[model samples]
Target: MPPRPRARTYDPAKTRAAVTAQLEHVRDAVRGLGEEQLAAPTRLGDWTVRELVAHLSMAVGAVGRHLERPAPPAPEVTATGWVAATAALGGDIDDDTRSLAASAAPAELLDRAAARFAELLPQAPGDRLLAARVGAMRLDDFLVTRCVELVVHTDDLAAALGTTLPYDRQALATATRLLADALAAKAPGGSVEVRVPPYAVVQCVEGPRHTRGTPPNVVETAPLTWIRLATGRLDWSEAVEEADVTASGERADLAPHLPLLA
Candidate 1:
């Protein structure tokens, strides 16, 4: 069968603004966390709050570095492929992030990183193509990945701190749509409708397609819950038992296709 269609086209201007706004929000939250809090353990296995913060900066600042280089001939991958690309550089990225966090004060590093992103981001053109290590992808398409990092890590920070940080609407929406599309791409099914309330809804899993009325299979959760599930931060069974996710229908179970980033 052909690949399931990707949902939710993002406007470059809106996406850029969202990334900027969300990064600022995360930086502001980071600034408030004391050194002790910054050193706290995160769900991301060996990564403390410090490493996570550094990773966020790496994600945002990468666009600047790519933009500084000449544009690539073409995008070797789609935004859909980016979700898979993340794992390839995991080791090196984590190493650099750990070194950066160790050498600088978390607060100061966040400040400098935010400033650098602010300065370099504006220089990138909307249509500029980036030669990402995983594959060539448009600068705008790459920004969508940034939104995922910013949103997901922001949630991680909040979870570790036992507090909630305000999420930028656009950032949350873009992150939701991207992950949802990634799930559809990975599963490539028309059986179940996965609904992330107030942000996105996608049909995935293999079965008979529902053309009208209620689908035979349905799964539902809020955006953050879905993000956590998709990224392995939350377990499917736990979510299902805690009422964080609602699932139904014979084909509704998505356990096999989950934790897409791992």
Candidate 2:
């Protein structure tokens, strides 16, 4: 078997700042919601806007909760691995988000979550291990995953409300890079060049390797479009039909390897 591709690295401080900025963006948008808007449905199964908003708090604030617990011994997941590990967790996540949505108003839930996150962030180091829901991971790695949760769900929240929320530059870039790397890990090779400009580029899918110049297979798209595709928010054929993604070469059809996370 071919060796596993090395996961890309992320800076913990930038990740932390991105998470904070994005959460504030979510909080700001949610604060203006009326009951009617909150009841609107999102593309994420049965979750309505309210449930989706509540889930952001649960997702980002998990850091503080983990820090309060006993440290786990060793790392078991990386930012890329977390993407592969999350598909099996849908049911549990749904239950938890529903419970959270029912417990408090979106504004209240997010405010408290944000306050706690800010209070706890400075107390620990990046290498501090936390037993994340997927597996034990360094605080730094886990923070990187928060980029995915915030950026993707923020997109969900916007789609549900028909509004655009601010995308923190670092948060969007980190999530884009993490998911891009996840794609490489999912289908390791060197035949295709997948690029999300101003953020990441990775080669994957086994074939004749491209040592230089134009690769035989190439796929390129905007970062948000790439994130939506990687998370199954956008369909492969549909993206191609609409010209949201450009593909070249037979090996470049990525429909068979997508939505690395549910």
Candidate 3:
């Protein structure tokens, strides 16, 4: 892989708030589900709503668990790199998620995990480096990764349950910006401008550069659609066919750079 770009900075406080808020959003939705709903299948291959919820707890719980370990000397991965790296660990994650789901009531599991996360996050230092599967990342960067996890999987839960789970605005914005920046890092150019309204606008792809005026190549979509596209939840052509995304200009085709994170 190409050298990782300089990691983006996130406000420590906002990240902490976002993580908590998004998790609570999922928690509230899960709390109201009946047994039948908990058993409903999700799009994440063989995982049910319960298992998906269990996995979400694991995602947030990771922060506290890592903080309990000895701090690492330095960070081993950039925030953007975490996105692409996750695809390789799918099998392990699936097994662990299933196991956790089977071990506790979904509501109980989520509550305990959320409580622990809430307790630990405030006490942790933002600059402290924690051991991550990818490598050591500062608490803040790791938390931003949590925003991506919470936001993306929350969408998964919503789709499975056939209900809208409201996004915490800061959480959605941070996740959107991180993924958009990841695309720019992956392509490394100013040839294409990708706009996710109200949150992110990034220039990417390698070709003729646009300095000012209307960008020669432009691709735009809503924030949720952009998230789905970046995370591989939505196909580029399918999104375009459904009118969910709009691209204009010869070099604006982003199929080659899309789903920046698997």
Candidate 4:
């Protein structure tokens, strides 16, 4: 693997708070979902609304499950590493999420997951190492991943339900920053500056570096649009075509480097 980039530092308290707030946002929305709505299709290919919610529970619940295991001697993965590693587990994740969704009502599963996560997360230290499938990762780092999960899936859930869902500000910010930083790590360089105003600004893509004044290449977009592009929910070319993203230089085209977290 490429040399691990310096990982971003996250406030453990803020991360935990963001996770809790976002999970509750999903819980509140799903509590009123009827069978018809629960059976609705989501953008995640075959997963229904029920399966997606179950997967969200699993995403949060994984932390507790790993914490219950013996702690690892050292963290084998950084937060950025976790981003690229997730795609490999797609098959297993799909199987487990489907199984869990079938085993209980969506509301009940979400409640239990929320309670379990709340109980275990508060007791665990930020440096505690988790026995994650991708590899051992720190509690704080893993929690940051959970923010991505909650924010991204909450959007998926909202899209499936054809209604807008409230997003926890901290949760959205953390998720956006993490993915933005991941993109920089994936394409390490100082040739391009990507700005997601108010949330993140990262330099990436290898070429002649800029040291002073304005960068030669700059790409700017909103937080949600950035999230969508990074996660493959939105296409880069389409975003540019629709003027959703502003690109001003030759190296500003990020199409080849997008969907960084597939």
Q: Estimate each model's TM-score.
A: 0.95, 0.98, 0.96, 0.97
Ranking, lDDT, top scorer first: 2, 4, 3, 1
User: For residues 97-162, could you state the per-residue lDDT of candidate 1 as single tens digits?
Assistant: 888878887767767767777787777776679987688888888988889989999998888888
What's the ranking of the predictions by TM-score, best on top? Answer: 2, 4, 3, 1
Candidate 3 accuracy as lDDT: 0.89
Best by lDDT: 2
RMSD for each of the candidates: 1.5, 0.9, 1.9, 1.7
lDDT minimum window of 10 residues, candidate 1: 1-10
Off by over 4 Å in 2: 1-3
Rate residue 210 of model 2 by lDDT: 88
lDDT to native, each model:
0.85, 0.92, 0.89, 0.90
| Candidate 1: clashing pairs of residues | none
| Candidates 1 and 4, the one with greater lDDT | 4
182 in model 1: Cα distance from truth in Å?
A: 0.3
Q: What residue runs in model 1 are displaced by over 4 Å at the alpha carbon? A: none
Residue-by-residue lDDT tens digits, candidate 4, 27-99:
9999978999999999999999999999999998898889889998988998888899998899999999999
Candidate 2 lDDT over 98-137, as tens digits, reads 9999999999999988999999998889999999999999
Q: Which of candidates 2 and 3 reaches a greater lDDT?
A: 2
> What overall lDDT, based on C-alpha atoms, would model 1 receive against the true structure?
0.85
> What TM-score would you give candidate 4 relative to the actual structure?
0.97
Pairs clashing in candidate 2?
none
Query: What TM value does model 2 have?
Result: 0.98
Give the backbone clash total of model 2.
0
The TM-score of candidate 1 is: 0.95
